[model samples]
Target: MKGTQSLERALDILFALGDDGETQTIAEIAQRISIPESSVYRLIQTLERNGLVERKGQGQIGLGLRILELAKSLNSQFRNRLKSSAAPLMEQLSEETKETVVLFVRTGTNVICVKSVAGQHLVRFVVEDGKTFPIQNGASGKAILAFETSKIINQVIHTIETDLVDDFLEELQVIREKGFSETSSEVDPGIIGIAAPIFDQANHVIASVTVAGPGDRIKDEKLSAIVPHVIKTAKRISSSLSFSTTLS
Candidate 1:
């Protein structure tokens, strides 16, 4: 570790533990990463003191609960950025369509609504923030899932009804082709939903922009009419997210 700075050496120790959450003794980590045992011990002490590492057994160390806290904080920050970027547009969409507008972010195998603007109409569907659903169930979730990597898509596919897997994959392909998704009562009875994916600076799917309402009032030609507006809003939000990243 002579050529490596202290910070770099510490990071190397962390990486040496592997991404699988495997625990290792200091000597094992030092030997695996080709660093001195004394240096590894010193760095582990620093990391343990900061609550980033913990003793898993008598001699083994593993990642600590604080790492999960740090990850949650990071995820919250990204969601906050998405909310800031999508809030104004969500309001505009709700006003234009007279329907509920929602911003959803993928969390694990589910998508959670992070921001929502209720519809102006007397009879409307109210989707509360923090509502969670399977990542492949609703229009908003499908929009996010369709753009995910094949590995992740397959992982989700394996969890569903095997008989429906083919149809689900086909629907995802159509969503990718049309650049948006639409559903009627798939997740909730009597609801219509339209959504498009939002992208980050790296062109990765970060979240989705969605419009939802009572199916009776928003079906057929009416739903079709709102599709373009939802797509446009998604693009605007994606652009805003990229711009904010640039500024930061």
Candidate 2:
């Protein structure tokens, strides 16, 4: 292979290892990628030196912690950008409602919490960064799903239990009409979550911003008060992302 071909082959090997998420012997990688065993070994040695791969045992290797280090750095940079765009609005919402505020993005069948601002109360619901949960059962999930096309919803529905599909679609429509979602004691008992979908420059729902709090404090009156703020915050964040994308 030429130098560029060799580099491409090396990347193919890396991708193979990543997809399997298992330790592989030199012969195994060679067979998987149709590379010669000798070439695989040489490529692996170079990858290992750069800390992209690590030996697992005799004649076996797996991805290294260095990949995770790189992932953390990338996630950090992305989170900083999202936080910078949303923090001021989130802080204001938290202060006004005194409830936990969170930002979430879809990941396959789940939504990952990316940023959060804690409520100023002795008792409040707080979601940690990187927390992931099913995209079928909560306000954030519904808000994100509501904006998706029916085709996308059908794709997600295929992953869900056959029995719950109808109700899921029904709720998504309600959220779509209201332009937000609110639920009490759905994910966690005694907690109420309200969320609105955030769109990108193309008007695609890419994320959601939520306000959640103890149910006792978020009864009818309180819920009525916070709903508009949550919706507004989501809109502002979406506008910011759209504007930034336009500039870039």
Candidate 3:
């Protein structure tokens, strides 16, 4: 329809402006997109009215704060869903293991802790919520990196300013074979953590679940004991996200 075409053009114009990260005059946009200057002006005015775009100075235009507001609203909805589904599982895991349980997502080259539940034990290593960790240093980060595609893995590695690429790759291979990753005092001194990847419906590693505690308390025997439980909990969380596991 003519109306739909007009709306699409207007959206394209706004997207172009967003990509440039700078204000553009009507004549400049019209020249770039090969559209009439009059049409460009009309579209800009319409977008401005809806707070999607705003005039910066003179004839220049840029995105408005309304888009950020919309993004925050969407992020809040995601946070609510994560809490409802993952929080209970985190609590259950913490109770069962008597260690701190955390949920993290890989953002760029860092893994961010989004949710955490403290164990019943009085003494435990505490990781703050919203903490960002490097991909090569922690159990949770390694678990996520091991399951991610080779391209993504390499991209993350490229961001690291270290000569440990070969070492990291070897560790990742081991993690892939073992179906989980573990580290002792790698990220935090005197602490040990084990992590398993949480996958989505398409088998994409979207996040990881980890259990961390004092090194002495998380010895090899205890880690071996907790492996099955951690894997099961990770699978349960994945299932709640509509992900099917291949684990028998």
Candidate 4:
């Protein structure tokens, strides 16, 4: 019983630290968890020794390199699963649209391309795998942002220009309602792209599937033809991922 209590207390402290992604002093952690400062200090010492927590400047503590190591391993495995499941569908979308197809997942405030299938045409816009861009622009970003929680949405908006925040939020709403997002020159000049969100078993937006091409070849008619295919491809990836999650 005593061991269990200590474990719970340690978890409480960890949870508190995760809330705002900020360093916290021992006193602050103890107060937040309603524990004695001395006990908190002992618990922190054990955590520090195990590489779960580390001291920041000015007597503050933050998550340690061990946590990042674990996160990296988990993220790599999860991204591999996502890429494998998304590849066939993305390839089909690329062939059908004759444009670049990319799979993007959010990391912090940025969206990264985990997989990209190049377009067939010589004039196609090329997006390489592992490319990262801010979530404040592009159809791929908007597709994922539209389904994010309100807190995350507001947090991302706070990083944008004050004058553009409202417009960006409104655009998210429109994207949510429309089931997908499309843009021209939003991230790259002379490029057009369309994207739809992929969801997990719990219905959280885990990623986005995007189709992009050179603007000259992707005029209104081309854009209209490809949007449904993008939406469909995203749906297939989401469905497959959700089903796989349930099996796991």
Candidate 5:
């Protein structure tokens, strides 16, 4: 195989392992990828030496701690960038709307809260850092679903066990057309949130910024008023990430 092909296969193996989230035998991996068991074993050995995969039991292998280390390092770097570039914008949004502002990034089929700032209100909602939520239940998730490729969006729809796929796509289309998404008492009763997508350097929606509060505090008029501010803050974060103005 060519060098690039080999590297791609290695990454594919890593992704497969992550998807399974458990140790698998060489034969199982080989069968999954339609590759020969001998080749799979050789690749597994190489990956083991590099600390990318580890043997868990007889003929079973899984991802190693090095991958976790790398993930942690990347997360730290992203958090630092967010603090330096997006934190001020989020703080400004919170102050302007007197609501909780949150930053979310896609993690597999879920969105993880990376940063948040609560408003001055005594009954404000709080989403702790590192907390994760389903991709079909919240404004931040809908913001991502609206902008991601159709392939990814379809995969999410296929995995859902409910009959709300049509409704979800209908709402996503509206959000895409309007440049933001909103949910009122969808994920949490009496709570509402508004979110706008944040683009990456390649103009892909890589994350989102959301402003949320209790429904009583975030009435229809207030939510409509803060939509522009939330969209503006998302644009600022996207700009800092080197996304083109066309995507904003």
Candidate 6:
């Protein structure tokens, strides 16, 4: 924890939201942390100012963009924990599927790749560690977005094209119901992507683990076989993430 009572309370607010597993109001946050509502309000304002948290609709609060920047120096420990949990599973998945593997975290209305494992095949799709794209673009993004709160879903909806809203939302619903997502030629040409969502202990969708490769090799039948491995690896990483004490 940080020094000073006020700073400590502010950090607890972020932790409380994560533990609760969803957005909450000022009162809910105060009760969860056992602090007065007024004190929580003030601390929340300060945190909001620093880009550490965000206010969802109807006064609910959530982890902000800065909090999701796992690869940055801002929160290296948790990033280390995330990578520690995902790296091996991702590596195993790439070896099993013979395709590129990627881990993605949401940043506001976009999704960023925090880590990647290249495939064994000569013509496989390649992913860069720092790659970023709109939240609506691919299976990697959609897998994470589909599990987010409605306010977040709507927030993203407002950023993309009007015509795309219907189809995108529809696709997200399918992803939510199915617990994964798939896309072809979305991020890159002739590439197919299949992704599964990863959750923290509180059951929040923290990120997504994706398997991607060329269309010719991954065509329908092979894609079906690879899906299960992607999902299983995602679950394994999520289970490892539960060992982390806090988002910090």
RMSD of each: 3.1, 5.9, 5.7, 2.4, 4.8, 6.7
What TM-score would you give candidate 4 relative to the actual structure?
Answer: 0.87
Question: Which stretch of 10 consecutive residues in model 4 shows the poorest summed lDDT?
Answer: 122-131
In order, how many clashes per candidate?
0, 0, 0, 0, 0, 0
Better of 1 and 4 by TM-score: 4
Predicted candidate 1 versus true structure: per-residue lDDT over 1-248, tens digit per residue: 45468889888887777454589899889888888899899999989999889999889999878877988899989988889889999999988999999999888789999999999999988888899999999999999999998867987998999999999999999999999999989899999899999998898998998999898999889998999999999999999988998999
Q: Per-residue lDDT of 129-162 in model 2, one digit per residue for the tens?
A: 9999988778998899888777667778998889
What does candidate 4's lDDT look like per residue over 1-248, in tens digits?
Answer: 28999999988988888787899999999999999999999998988999989999899999888878988999998899999899999999998998899999998889999989999998888888888999878999989999998878987988998999888888899999999999899899999989999998788999999999888999888889999999999999989988888888
RMSD of 1: 3.1
Quick one: ranking by TM-score, best first? 4, 1, 6, 5, 3, 2
Residues forming the 10-long window of minimal summed lDDT in candidate 3:
239-248
Candidate 5 matches the true fold with a TM-score of 0.73
- Model 3 Cα shift for residue 164 (angstroms): 1.4
Q: Cα deviation in Å at residue 153, candidate 4?
A: 3.2
lDDT of each: 0.91, 0.89, 0.84, 0.91, 0.87, 0.88
Best by TM-score: 4
Candidate 2 accuracy as lDDT:
0.89
Estimate, for each residue in 76-132, the C-alpha lDDT of model 5 and write its tens digit: 887677666788889899999999999998887889898899887999988899999
Report RMSD for candidate 6: 6.7
Candidate 5 minimal-lDDT segment of 10 residues: 239-248
Which residue pairs in candidate 4 collide? none
Query: Candidate 6's residue-wise lDDT over 1-248, tens digit each?
Result: 23598878887898898765589999988988898999998888888898888999999898888776742665567567888889989999999988999999888788988999999987878878778999888999999999999888988888878998898888898888888899999989999999999998999998999999888899878999999998999999998888655543
